[model samples]
Target: MMAFANFLFIVFLLPSLEALSNVNPSEYQQELNTQALILQACSNVENLSSCLSNFQGELQKSGPPTAQSIIHAALRATLDEASRAIDTITKFNSLSISYREQVAIEDCKELLDFSVSELAWSLMEMNRIRAGIKNVHYEGNLKAWLSAALSNPDTCLEGFEGTDRHLENFISGSIKQVTQLIGNVLGLYTQLHSLPFKPTRHDHNATTTKSSSDKFPEWMTEGDQGLLKGSSLGMHVDAIVALDGSGHYRTITEAINEAPSYSTRRYIIYVKTGVYRENIDMKRKKSYIMLVGDGIGKTVVTGNRNFMQGWTTFRTATVAVSGKGFIARDMTFRNTAGPLNHQAVALRVDSDQSAFYRCSMEGYQDTLYAHSLRQFYRECEIHGTIDYIFGNGAAVFQECKIYTRVPLPLQKVTITAQGRKSPHQSTGFSIQNSYIFASQPTYLGRPWKQYSRTVFMNTYMSALVQPRGWLEWYGNFALGTLWYGEYRNRGPGALLSGRVKWPGYHIIKDARTAKFFTVAQFIDGMSWLPSTGIKFTVGLGN
Candidate 1:
């Protein structure tokens, strides 16, 4: 923990270091090292002077604080700042001049609300770590939640892109401070979390399955794995949704609303074939909910809310999921707002340990929003024109079909806009053994944040992907920092001769190295995915 001895030193602590001659040399050096770590943690903050002043002479001359204390203090400070940010956003929510700005402020309020929750969760997790209950699960959850909290500010600000800047300018400083504090705490967490990732082949003692094999997770049963194999009509369902009066509910939203909250067992909702024209928002409180539809195109959930219609990109989803263990199969989510609507999303998922199979997301821009946590998609059809498949979640798309539609004339198109802000955060988009069918030429992805990461492995790409496989967000922006890699991709667009020369782009010729981006290692799906009833390739085995 005292490894940051050579890191940045605070100006106020120089006098104590200068007086080291009169004290025990090793003891005084250790104190200075601790002070140096604190300074280094706050050094990269956007508002450095303000963050340094936040300590308020807390560095006493008596003794050095322990590493655990430093981590807890940082978490507490971040939580406090996030609470204040929520207040500032709420005040602005009451003062927007125009209707569109008010709507944008509403979206801001929702985003800040989530940020506050995540910050509080971070504090609780830090308390657990302080109590000597640290592990890889605790560390992973903290990283994901903190990273998601850090991204809300940018998304909140983006809602006012074409509107007046009054509300934007008013909340910018407060939100930026929250992001800075989040980044600082992330840095400190990376230094403090000492555990390594559990091994890929490590067998977890799963008590849920009866076979005695270490296959499925303790949360999933053996019968669950056999559900997706064939028709589940004989399977017991908690609710039935049909357009006709034969079923229990007429609308899909009604059935979803009736779902049990925080359900430990899978609460299945079988939806009959019909076009559901509803905007459904599945909140985080509803966990372990599974939605089964008749089939893609037969079971459609369509909406027209879009950014051009005064709805923020964060709120334009036809269907949004924010719960844990959300599973959806044989469904189609569609946004009929057309290409001119700018940022309409069909399916937005903020869910954890979520899986989608045999589904389709149709739109012009931002069709599928993998917003946070661990997600997996298999054999799905995703269609869009712009940066459609985007977000900060650690997601894996296996055996899926990605179709790039024609964009508006003179508008350049990109496939993804991954929003990863911190390097330590285990969040990225991995397309494995899939196909990219493009109707027009497009770039692979542009970095939405400085630390964005995405990779395409063993995927087939059409010629419309263009010779320049990757695009830059802007000149000299995240071009040098974002990581973009392609491994063993086959097709005319996968040629490396014409790829852009960026420091972050890689051809990835090594075999073992490519395994790091697989479903098993990237999203840690080996544990939870075995009993999902969806077929997935765990690793890139020879």
Candidate 2:
């Protein structure tokens, strides 16, 4: 019996001893080689050289620590080395090319891809070491200590098991950090690459450019060409319509139907200040269209189309955009259907690369349907009661105001319902530099399905945002894979002290880990988008 007790004690004590064992020399050597390869992949001369130096120093400093400690130290060193490499990449500049001209800057992009892949593989190996520790027997409450260390989502290693919350959180955080580093690296790459080797001199004899060009400001123009000027493009609208009181078009549909669809020139149907009571749909071939209104608050497009009306929640849209490259600025899309009538969408955007600027979208349920493809919304207002912003698309909401109208009596709900379907689709909503307000108490978001992913970054939230910011939509078992996180958020809603036990939502404490959702990573704004005069934020710090 005494021998058995000693055996048990030995078994228990082995894990702690193992924890102190020297890190595998082979693994350490492999990490060094991989780090060098990753740095070379970044292709930044200065960054690569600096990282190489740092990596050598770290390896030399690694001494007689246990295998677990050495592994931890190695992971930390790898992360630091990766960060330095990313910093170097961020300083790179992009090469400039004439409009419609193809540039050969794929080298940097390819290098970045390889680096990211290598980093991902390295992280996986680190996770394996972490997982192995769990199986190690420890002495004198070593399990408790191990549990505590692993409890910290950052250091805990993870495996492929679906129930491993620690691993999930760690990967989420790591991905976010790596993404940001990639962004910075890309930003620097663009800047450096775009620099002209030879500077051009100005000619004083050239004709002076007009002080007030007819072109619309570049900020207002879509990605196509120069902005449309009222003088050059003729009157923006052939006619003006107001629905509140005096106007030619009484209902919103009338104005839309009467508007010329096949104009050779770009035509904008400017709606004057008023709330139009009608559901609007833009059919196919409604090309080169632009909808401009007085303001989001003053110009409202609203309707009540619910599921009971034989309409799928997707079809019952107050305003549906089917035409490609459709643009709506300073307007409001609203569905009057209360929560009692579920699945009423205010706006369904089926068009590709559609953009909404300074607009407002409001509804009780399924308010904004970012249905398909990539969509961008900036400085807009979105309000809804339940699953308000739900869809499967690569949609980005930047510097927008999100409000949750008080849920009516008998209604218990959450706010955002991101319905991302797959990991490869690149379809999800990124809410950055935004504000979340709840008219009634609400949860920040809930998984609409398995693999549903949404990110909120540098946003402000009200107390109405529940401490458990995310809730499960029904009891979907697949939600274990859903990705949700909050970083550097302020207000009562930001408190993560008593968050739910689910492994999806992460309170990212490190700024390095919050980069995945930044402007650079989400849209590669650093390269092509900055020319638009839109300020693209870099890194995870606000």
Candidate 3:
């Protein structure tokens, strides 16, 4: 009986043990490769140890790792550690992989060229992060080891190559999936790190020469006096109060109430970073007053004023500026009332010669009311749904972004509903070299009055714009005198052949007539504006 038992053990149990012991050569090789890749990819000591510990456990459990499984495990483990760290590692892997995958996508051959450039850009970003990591101080020896690993070309390149292949193969199999993944993962990273990559004065000057329409001339020059003088001019005010460290007053209206009358020199108010929830009314004496904030997105002034809330369409404004020469920069004005309510104004600039630079005006309906005077917006973002940028003022939008959100039913209307009452007012809305985007289909312009005028010149119109660029307000017959025209507009929505036949729109067949709207003419930009650190074009030669 003992002999028989021993034979059974040898035949069954021994074979089972041996089968478990014998690791596949391919899997063993793959496991080793995966371990090396993970080690090289680790950004810090803690992450490195965590990755290595996970790998050891994985190896003990599986004996060996399949190439695909190992790669997947490594990525999953990295992502589990830290959100930012995982993003950095995945982006590093995606460059070459994205390129390979994009090339293999069916019917995407035409887009391959753009994909290559994008891949190169991702590589550059990875290189930059690697370089930045060296300067970061960590607690221990992990930093030294990570630095050494990054410097080792063979190990780094090997891991990079493997990840590249994985991405390429995955993307090739499902182009849309890979594209979406890359966009989500890398896009978030890019957005998080966007501040570092923003263009500075030096960068901008190196890229584009001084044109007549530039709003930042002082930053473009070699003289410190220009900057100091501009600052002094901007800082000049009737009354001043250092807010201690408070950064902001109790209310914007309080600050204005404390301000001296028009007889006093222009009042200057400097606000710090904080949410100011109050409606502001700038009377006539507030002329030449400047309101400066830390940043447009950071320093926010918000309210819930809409036409439906017992306030007139003109009175329901978070901020109503009636003072002339009112300049506001680096501040956000927002209205909480949504588009469904209609005519929710975040800002109503009724003052003449009022300018907004590097600011943000946000709301749903009638976000910005350029009610009267000459207004200029440079590098500003204006967001709304219906008639977001409107009024009787002669306003110029230069290098700005216009956003249109979806509106409720029966509220469908134009993005800009210009209300110029007469041509003698020298009032119109001119959008120049700007971007117009809509969350849903929208008309470019609509007549709000008898002689409403709006012009889009050298602008980018997104496909969300309706086929007919202009719409008559309430289907009014008086729109025959409304001037709605487009010159040198690019994008799918700027098809002029399909536009409405309005007498006010001049096809602009010649360059001479078009020159009237150039940067120089818009601001008479070459004279006083240049001293204020602005440069306008002399002619089309720019």
What's the TM-score of each model vs. the native?
Answer: 0.88, 0.54, 0.55
Candidate 2 per-residue lDDT over residues 387-433, each given as its tens digit: 88876656678788998786768665576777654443345678877
User: Would you list the C-alpha lDDT of every candidate in the order shown?
Assistant: 0.79, 0.56, 0.56
Candidate 2: RMSD over Cα atoms?
19.0
Model 3 score (lDDT): 0.56
Across residues 1-542, which tens digit of lDDT does each residue of candidate 1 receive? 22332232345556667777688878887777676667765665655555555643333321246665666666666777777887777877668777678877887777777777777777787667656673545655777777777777788888888787888988888888777777777777777666322212533332112221334444444454445655553566789899986899999889888998878777888888999999999988788888989889999999999988878888899999987889999999999999988999999988878999899999998999888878999899999988999988889998899998889999778989999988877789999889999888888899988999999998999888889898878887888788999998999888889998999898998866678788666777755676565677777632
Off by over 4 Å in 1: 1-23, 44-64, 195-226
TM-score: which is higher, 2 or 3?
Answer: 3
The best candidate in terms of TM-score: 1
TM-score of 1: 0.88
Question: What are the per-residue Cα lDDT tens digits for candidate 3 across 1-542?
Answer: 44553343344334434554568877656544544443433322332344456644543443344332333333333223323322333443335434323222211321222232323333344344435543121111111111111111111112223133654343332333223222222322322333343222111111133433444433233332232233433343333323344533556677777766663333557676778888987875666666766677777889997766545456667998866567777789999999767778899875545678678999988899876645777778989888888776667787888888777887775778776543333457888778887777889878876777777877888887887787777766556787777878888887788787777766665555655554445443333344434332344332
Which consecutive 10 residues in model 2 have the weakest lDDT in total?
Answer: 98-107
- Which portions of model 3 show Cα errors greater than 4 Å? 1-248, 263-267, 522-528, 531-542
Evaluated at residue 343, the lDDT of candidate 3 is: 72
Q: Name the runs in model 2 displaced over 4 angstroms.
A: 1-239, 243-266, 509-513, 524-541
Per-candidate RMSD, Å: 4.7, 19.0, 26.3
